[model samples]
Target: MIKAAESVGIRAEWVTCQNAGQLMKCDALFIHGTSSINHHTYRMARWAERERLAVMGDPQSIIRCTNKVYLAEILERAKIDTPATIVVPRGNAD
Candidate 1:
């Protein structure tokens, strides 16, 4: 993503929750690897929000996209192809 941005003449850098301080100086924030709402990315996203910096995948987007059920529903509504999916109850680990 950074490479693609650089190609377009937008200098981009990857930062993490550990370097959130550095993010405050950036013009924009494009978070990656936010696998779950509980992940550190959420904290960074929230921080970005407070700072009012533009985020590539906004916090709400992160929340919905990180959950398979919500993402599948969104894809279905958009008529986007996705692998067959099922939502199992939390206790049914098997």
Candidate 2:
């Protein structure tokens, strides 16, 4: 991936993206997925939003695939109840 970037004269910087400090160095993020990230990464994503850098590709594809709650929300919104759900802490969140 870095090689492909270098081919186009674009410099790729790899850093420990724990927050805006990391994303602040880049102009954009072509996020292929979010399966490998933890909660801290979400904070970085929020920072990216605040910083106004472009985040490409389907973030949900990785996020929802890794997070059960998020995936459930997508399914529910699509009216596709693919899982047997029982929300113990179900409240008037909606």
Candidate 3:
């Protein structure tokens, strides 16, 4: 992805935990890893958005996509077929 971006004359750098501080210098952020609300990638995305940097996998999307129950509800409402699913409440999984 870096190579492709550079090919188009768009300066890009791979940000990792070691060099995440460099994110402040970037014009945009493209996360290339798994993202969840409790993960570092999510924090990075949130920070990027807070700093007004263009970001893929924005915080809101991450929040919505990471919650399985929310996704199930959305799919069901949209009439999208899915395998049988049961959402058992925590501590009530008897």
Candidate 4:
């Protein structure tokens, strides 16, 4: 991904949790790892959004997409066909 970006004249660098502060210096963020609300990736996404940097997998998306029930509802509301699904509420899976 870095090579492709640089080939097109777009600068891209890898940022890890240890050096996430570098996000402030980037014009965009492309999270290349799993994102969870309890994870640093989510924090990074939120920070990038607050800084107004283009962010793929933005915080809101991470929140909504991470919840299977919510994602199902969205797909249903949008009339997008999906495989048959059943949502088992917490503690009700017996």
Candidate 5:
């Protein structure tokens, strides 16, 4: 993903959470979508926020984007722009 951005001329870096011991000397962080935005990831993301690091998509916002549930809501709400979600859900779905 960072590669995609860099391909478009956006400077990007890849760093593991284990290697991310401090943010005092850093500028920003990019936490991408993962299988589960678990405790450690969440902790690091939050710390980066408090330290004012520029986050691509904030997890604190209901963990939705990084959190699937919120993605559904956002998609549903923007169904006009994303008509695919306008389709009714299965089994008693509105």
Candidate 6:
């Protein structure tokens, strides 16, 4: 993705949530991959939100996209097609 962006004359730099200072320097933010709910990336997203920065994907959207339960709710609300889904207790598969 970075290569493609750069090829199009878009200067893109790779950085992690830990590099929030550097990230803020960029014109926009792109979270290339998903992270656990407890990940620091979420905090970074929150920071970006507070700063009104141009985030490629909004923080709330990122949270929803990363969590199956939330994603299911969104899909159902939008009447989008999705395969049958069932959520069982964490420890009890039965």
**Model-by-model lDDT, in order?**
0.80, 0.62, 0.92, 0.93, 0.65, 0.77
Q: Give the best candidate by TM-score.
A: 4
Q: What is the model-wide C-alpha lDDT for candidate 6? A: 0.77
Per-residue alpha-carbon lDDT of model 6 for 1-94, expressed as tens digits?
A: 8999999999988878556688667777777776555777777777777887777666787677888987887798899999997777699997
lDDT of 5 by residue, 1-94 (tens): 7789789987666656777775555688776545246656667777788889886545565276554556767777677355354435468575
Looking at candidate 3, what is the lDDT of residue 84? Answer: 89
Query: TM-score for model 5?
Result: 0.56
TM-score of 2: 0.50
Best-fitting candidate, scored by lDDT = 4
* Model 2, position 38: C-alpha lDDT score: 65
Superposed on all Cα atoms, model 6 deviates from the true structure by an RMSD in Å of 2.5
RMSD (CA, Å), each prediction: 2.6, 6.1, 1.6, 1.3, 4.9, 2.5
**Considering only N, C-alpha and C atoms within 3 Å, which residue pairs clash in candidate 1?**
none
lDDT of 5: 0.65
Tens-digit per-residue lDDT, 1-94, candidate 2: 7789999999876544534366767888665334344654555555565678776533444465776777777788899957587444557556
What candidate 6 gets wrong by more than 4 Å, as runs, is 87-94
Counting clashing residue pairs in each candidate, in order, gives 0, 0, 0, 0, 2, 0
lDDT winner, 4 or 5 = 4
Q: What local lDDT score does residue 58 receive in model 6, on the 0 to 100 scale?
A: 69
- Candidates, ranked, lDDT: 4, 3, 1, 6, 5, 2
User: Please, what are the lDDT tens digits per residue for candidate 1 over residues 1-94?
Assistant: 8899999999888787667689868877887674467888887877788789997777888778777888888898899998897778899979
What overall lDDT, based on C-alpha atoms, would model 4 receive against the true structure?
Answer: 0.93
